[model samples]
Target: MASIGLMGEQGVSAEAVPSLHERDLLLRRLADLAVLPPGRVTPQERALVDMVMATAVSRLDVAQRCRIAERVAQLPEGPRELTLALARDTIEVAAPVLAEAANIQGSDLVEIVRVTSMDHRLAVASRKILPPAAIDALIEYGNTDVLRRMLENRSIEISSRSMEVLVRRSASEPELHAPLLERPELNQRLALLMFWWVSSGTLRVEILNRHAVERRMMHIAIADVLEGGLAASGADEALRVALSLVHPPATIAKPQLTRLVNLATLGQREEFVMELAREARLRPETALRIVSDFGGEPLAVLAKALGLSRQEFGDLIVAVAELRSGYVPAKSDIERITAVFDAISTDRADLVLHLWDWSISGEAQFPLPAEE
Candidate 1:
């Protein structure tokens, strides 16, 4: 079949163009040489091919060069010099060999990528089993077409960091969404992160349905994954969330916080945690978690949300610390907790409080955004 693709960069150069008759003879000879045994190019064959090519002109147009490249690329020892020459030829002549020639190893792909245009880069991107170095180069320099082809090329492996970059870039390229979502590398956390940034409402819902964190699941995950997590207590976290929802602690009036603060001051830990839970609309276990945390940041934030005065906040810290052990917070710890209260805005505290209301009790005071 005739070479069927674009004609590109339609000219070649040599020190001497052989006479028409000489050119015809060399063309016939090169054709014969291209059919030689795989990996069997003799020293004699190389010498003759080189001598003739130096003077033998290619009346061969781009298509014919592509044809010659096709044939030469098939022969295991076709002619390394000739295959390389054609591979560096115009985009049309080079693309087929670059895309499908298994013999074009990683290093050769690298060199071709450096010297050729977009067609070559795209071809390199579509190859099966691309070398890590070749993938690195494509990720760095390949254009949109090349990037799309690589993302779709399931046979190729992409580095994680490169996939991360692609995920980030997809924020801008709406065209990239489908293939990116299908990628095995697009895990739940990254997909959720991307969902918030994506403009597509449909995609956002799809992501939420597929990867949404249930409240119980989230609390359990935190309990399992957090540093110094609450797992040592040996309580089932799901049951805690369940009980918090079913038999909640009674609500405490604002005046009750001062009374609870006094009880906490007297080392009555249970009364303080229970009343704090009541005031904050948290389960006793959840409230106790914040109070028991060594860093004290959660309690600080909750206190800030509850509108506790700085002095009451200090006493609350001391009372909660006495729950687990006699570990009085250091001066630096006290400073950090105080900073949390000062830095956290009221609106931020309200948001957290609302989420606690919604997630734990299935009640939201604020309406969700209207669906598009």
Candidate 2:
């Protein structure tokens, strides 16, 4: 029965402009309708109220619109068009609904994330329940601040793909490291990949403690295959990598230990990788990962697995440091690396190395069976 026009458009008629009192009255009625029990308002009545409120909302000042948003955010069911209008408003008007509205569709939230400001995206990230698509949209468009909030939300389950994106991004934005590690969705594969660049000792320990699982079930499942010679020759590379973890050969050809150090110091990465792979009985690619890792823990594990003496381990650390230009290992860095090497026995280091082998051989999709 009434017409509402845009507030400042050229073609507005004076009669169509609602006074502030009328606008407040409309918002009050909308708020009233929002809290009504499910059946109290008929569908047609609700639609009419929604239409009136949506039109009037745009004309209201920010504070009034914000009050409506805060009110609607608490309702189990609110007018869809009105909620979306408020959600698309400025952050002050949008935050409440974006973060708490129960009836907002996942798709609508995704749309808001795509077109909204950082504050708007942050509000969406703060929601207690984020759908996968919405989570993906936030990761795709959000910055480190948004990601930190989402990763710390703990109420959401991040998909594997989103987790991968965050892990890769964390290489550059170290601020994401703690929150990302805190996510329950973070699995061993991701944690290990993150091991290369994560800077803190605590986070590094968190990764190793949570992810360095022994493949006990896999060891049992393939014990017969190995004994029967199935895995020795004809088995897939994944199986071979798995088999190595369970039963390392009695003797690996030992490279002259000093030569390994010399190659690493000279930045002859290819030769060092080749010799380390041969000595550690690992694939060359896995060896390359050890040498190329930005953190020293992987190299530490390799040294321990190869039974390097403390003096030799120290030399290897210096040599590896030489590969990265202008990079010098602090005393703390060497101490942390040494602590890691000393903490893990040779057997455990060997298992970690084989796990890397399995991961890098493109067989991580065939994940190791959960330990029984």
Candidate 3:
């Protein structure tokens, strides 16, 4: 292969420098050679092309380099070194190769994600299929925009660990909520945890509609154990809570429930939480979580589970909203809470309550045995 000798160190005279047409021709030739099938291009030819591009690529203008990148990106089996060179170029030059090249190895993608700009990361995130290592690197170095791109990329199969990290991030990065919720990788447990922080009524409703599963299978699986007194013996805290939901104690009397609502209305948070816990047969911590949830769906579910009338549920929503400082329940808020309460059946509400209890106890797992 003839040297382009475009490097400054070569001391080529200004008059001797290649013309724009000549430089474009060289770039086109390099791209043409790079994409040739192995059977069509010899090892010697491949090596020479790689060697020439290694030096000549730096001399091309951005448009010329991007042209080569766009062409090389479609190659079924291009030179890996050429792909890496183009992928490491400016985002304008690298975007095509990073987002579309199949020959770029997973490890190379990881390195690119680590060292590149946000634009490069965004391009990588848009790839048709991202490897796990590449996904991890993106999550580690990417900001919210990069992650949102990955979450929206339906072709990417994000690992459970990565999903967990994003779910945790979604608490503070509200921009990630919709895309993260849409990801197929999200499971019920993570969705439930995200429920407490998600502010969108549509998203909160989606979470409950999708994750508030019935516990019939669990009930069937543990029927024998409950009958045998294992739950009473404290074999498993989660199971014990599940059993409580199965054979609930006497309902909290209406007067007592009204007193709890009054406490919340008056902003007596601790007292309201404690009284609700006692009457609902819940741990104070569990009741606190339900009471603290600003979305009001969980509390609505709890209200339904306890057989509260629609009016009582509306009152609880108002009281809880007042309990949280500076938050006043709007008419729309009351209607939303009432709709949620009315939509849930008593049986499903009981199961959701049991699941919330188990989640609060720190025992929630994906694909719970019952779910499986």
Report the number of the highest-lDDT candidate. 3
lDDT of each: 0.62, 0.77, 0.78
Off by over 4 Å in 1: 1-18, 39-59, 73-78, 212-372
Candidate 2, pairs of clashing residues = none
Per-candidate clashes, comma-separated = 1, 0, 0
How does residue 326 of candidate 3 score in lDDT? Answer: 51
TM-score of candidate 3 versus the correct structure, residues matched by position:
0.80
lDDT of 3 by residue, 223-341 (tens): 66766685355657666765665643235689998898889888898998889887777778889888876667788888988888888777777778778885866778767977889
Candidate 1 Cα deviation (angstroms), residue 153: 1.5
Q: How many clashing pairs in candidate 3?
A: 0
Cα error, candidate 3, residue 361 (Å): 5.3
Report per-prediction Cα RMSD to one decimal: 15.0, 7.2, 6.5
Tens digits of per-residue lDDT, candidate 2, 1-372, equal 242321222322466656745655556656567546569779888788887777778876676677778878887877888899899999889899999998899899889999999999999998999999999999989999999989889778888988877887787788999998888888766777677668787787677777765555766776666666643457486576657767642333345787877887888878888987988878997887788766688888888778887888888888877777637678888888889888877766777777667656753543332324
* C-alpha lDDT of residue 258 in model 2: 78
TM-score per candidate, chains pooled: 0.51, 0.80, 0.80
Error of 2 at 316 (Å): 4.3
- Candidate 3: global Cα-lDDT? 0.78
